[model samples]
Target: MTEEAEEELAEAIQLAQGLEVRGVNLANEGKLNGAMEEFRTALKGLEKFKRRTKLIRARIHYFIGNLHTLQGDLPKGLQEWQKAVRLDASLTDARMNVIKSLSDQGKHAEALRHAQLANSQPSPRVEILVMEGDECKALRNFTCAKLAYARALQANPRSFTAHFQLAVAHRDLMEDVPALHHFERAAEIDPTSSSVVNALAVVRGDTCQWGDPDFSENSPTNLLSVFATRDIHDKASPIHPLLLAYHLDNATLLRVVVDSQAREAARDAAVSVGHAAIQQHTNRPDPHARPRKMFSYKNTFSAFW
Candidate 1:
């Protein structure tokens, strides 16, 4: 090929690599469909040049394999990974994918061997360590899983997933205290994670830290708090809010206010504070709006009529 054609091929391959990186990111974030679109786009770009497409093509295949794995097509995913390795044998990422797929297929020995080989690579990544832990967990090796998760944690303490997986490992091993501790930390980092919340609740139940058997009905005291911060489940419920409010209060929550005389005061204080927070959230002045309202519509109609 001419020098100009080679340069164009290099540029196209570079564009494909960027697209594949974006696809990998999207896949990591659990956007499989969108990630697949990006992968296909990258593949198309890589297919444009007849020369020097092996590296970029291998990378694209690796990403597509991840998409398949996420979509639960393990056989297809492993096939894609094999294709990736065949195209470019030096791609450690493809090797990692192969190890993960082998582990998922219950081929523990082969997976472990691949992991050992990958560890000998010049540089190691936390993802490889996490996959090692995943392999252990799949083999019902909680101890090994915990160790791997701890290593990942040491690498990056801010990883909510490592904390969560470590908590699960502890839970599986019947290590309640450590399990609860890790679960709580995970919850604090990702408060919106239902899995963490549910796991924390279950652990608390086992440890006698939680007592409520059901939350289908909101308690009298919690009614105020629940209204102040109810979730989608509460919205879907058929129960009448007022009727739901008649349930006995949480004794644990009520204990926050020491004196009986101050109990009601505390409840009122909490309600007022919560209400103000909600009001402030709702009443944030619109950035794109008139500076001020000249007249209030409701009061103006009432006064004029």
Candidate 2:
């Protein structure tokens, strides 16, 4: 493209971005129809620019997809996201959304195909690789999942999700030593993450490495102490339930198991209560009431990039 053409494309993209911001604000204000109109208007304006506006067009489609899902039209939402990636192969967020939606709908093979398409992009995102690993895991292709996660780690060494999931992939393949190493790294990276702490503790206990002086230099010698010191009533779910049955005595294990069950039951009860409240509010709309976070879709969609 000529310099003038490049400048025109940039100007067009800037206009579309402004429209996207307006659309997002309207959506946040619970004006779904207005948001949809703003997005469609942006799409119509971009149509004339053709290939130059491909990325922005894809983004607009992705936003439209989110709006569709917000309006409880999931199938239509999926179609919009699919249209997005077809417009621009490098639209990472749109492709990731497609991969996740397909995987959630139990279309693992299709998700894998989209993930592989990311390889064609100049620099596929680390999150895409992680999701690729996830799809592989769903398909019972642990080796493939491991490879994807390893690539993700190579791209971002400190990604807690990659390390944790890589550990899990290793565990699935019965590679205890590598799993232990990754789990330790994951725990170190995010000590407050209860799931990682639990996984690390369980692996150490199972491998008879608790308090072993030869633990990794990055890991604490008394790693199990961290798990032991955590609050007994932590709300986060355990990543591995097998931790309950691992190294504790029968009585202590029984008490811990009962507490965990109680916590889960309480959580479920709270969710039910919240759902009931939401339903009641929906049934009686208050025109004067300000919008609150009834759901997190707005935040989630913004964070896609």
lDDT for every model?
A: 0.60, 0.69
**Which candidate has the top score in lDDT?**
2
- Over 1-305, each residue of candidate 1 has an lDDT whose tens digit, in order, gives 89998898878877877887788788777788998998888888777673578877886787788677668887988898888877876677787778866765679877766665665465556666666677787778888888888988887787777888888888888898898788767756765554553465456546644333344444322333343243434332111111111222433222221222133344443443233333333322112211111110010100100
RMSD to truth, every model: 17.8, 13.7
**Span of 10 residues, lowest total lDDT, candidate 2:** 290-299
Identify the leading candidate in terms of TM-score: 2
Q: Candidate 1, residue 269: CA error in Å?
A: 32
Worst 10 residues of 1 by lDDT: 296-305
- Candidate 1, position 48, lDDT: 63
Clashing pairs in 1: none
